[model samples]
Target: MIEPASYSATEVLRDGRTIEIRALRPQDQQALISALDRSSPQSIFRRFLGARHHFTEQEISYFVNVDFVHHVALVAVADENGKPVVIGGGRYIVIPRTAKAELAFAVVDQYQRQGIGAALMRHLVILAHNAGLEELVADVLASNTAMLKLFENTGLSMSTTRESEIVHVALGLSLPA
Candidate 1:
């Protein structure tokens, strides 16, 4: 049985619109898959960095099964007639060897630049810090200017490079004391 997560509600304003951000729950899988499937091929490629389309069942199951101890995932959503629609999501994987983790996120095309991505990133940063992670890293395509800007706006120290037309980025997190 998939259980719903209890997340404190929060909102962000972008382009004169409001979006709600919160933690991911198992119940969100269907909505997430639907949004990802509907995403444009270019957007999907930028997010996943490959021409290989479609998320495998095993990947979906793993994303939906994360716990606070090992992983943290959050989603941004909008409610229409009481039905939740996923607009964006963020996740971090904690590396046991060193208190660091890799982060990833995506906002639906319609929701891009609407503060959904920024909110999700902020949420994940806090989650990672609280979970004892000292740094968060992301591997983004060099052409992904929007994502690059989002990371820059977070005020974290970052390094980037262009390798074969792909930009790789890394950000160090400063956990609040």
Candidate 2:
């Protein structure tokens, strides 16, 4: 009976820095934008799987606003000097009328390889399972080895299919984590 919308936890990065992982709030819109700004073009391309410039108004709203049931999103926040900065985020959106959800994640370029992405994946999987989702899927670029490895290391029953330059991964959630 965990509420995904109000979910929160503290995670330590590989380098031993502590971060707060919590539900993405509407007020986090600006922080998301700031994170995006801090990311390099290569990191953005890896996350979005394509060249992207900016998000439209509707896209920004969709990214920040979640229904908590159908769409669940979480963000990793860390203290930067005196301000809280959004370092990374992950989300799962249920497929209509299906027991599966689509997963996505993005970590700030500087935070890459610090186990932030893994932390986000772990939290998202828990929320998905609590929400009654049977599986989670992700479409990653063929060149994104880190993401593919993250999925593989989850210890869930997983399968992958490749199409063109994309690798689609599916992870069954019923297995014990």
Candidate 3:
């Protein structure tokens, strides 16, 4: 497995502002909290699939301390008044003994529709493909049309299953021959 900590890239948003995409670090716990504070409750609900205001100690640890091999994570950092801030993040957790992983992403409310999520998805796809993963899956709320459209725009062969109010999206990582 490659060192996920070594992963970093720069992305240009729709407004022509540059943002850095890098691996999530243990020290980023506070930044994550700040980002969450900047996000709207509706945005949080879509990403988490429910309403949540606080993360437990265990949950924070699990989110920050990634193994890089099975649980890979990346964060989007943008300049905020000359200081870099965590505005968004994406991750994939490989299902053990399988070539499939579940994907998740979150971008602060103010930064939505600025292409941050797409940038994170592009980087994560590269990492997952290099790691020999065959597919990435996400469980998005049916009401989250933006996220559903983002997955659709990935250009990957996708299949979705609707269960109640949730849409399970599976994106094939391998290119067609």
Residues 9-90 of candidate 3 have per-residue lDDT tens digits of 9999999999999999999999998999999999999999999989999999999999899999999999999999999999
RMSD of 3: 1.0
Model 3 TM-score relative to the real fold: 0.98
Q: What are the runs in model 1 whose C-alpha is more than 4 Å off?
A: 1-5, 175-177
Which lDDT tens digits does candidate 1 get at residues 71-162? 87788888757877887788888877988888888777877777888888877776666666778877888788888899999988788877
Q: Candidate 2: where are CA atoms >4 Å away?
A: none
Question: Which sections of candidate 3 miss by over 4 Å?
Answer: none
lDDT of 2 by residue, 75-166 (tens): 99999997899999999989999999999999999999999999999999889988889999999998999999999999999999999999
**RMSD, one per candidate, in order:** 3.5, 1.1, 1.0
Cα lDDT, model 3, residue 94: 100
Preferred candidate (lDDT higher): 1 or 3: 3
Colliding pairs, model 2: none
Overall lDDT per candidate, in order of appearance: 0.77, 0.94, 0.95
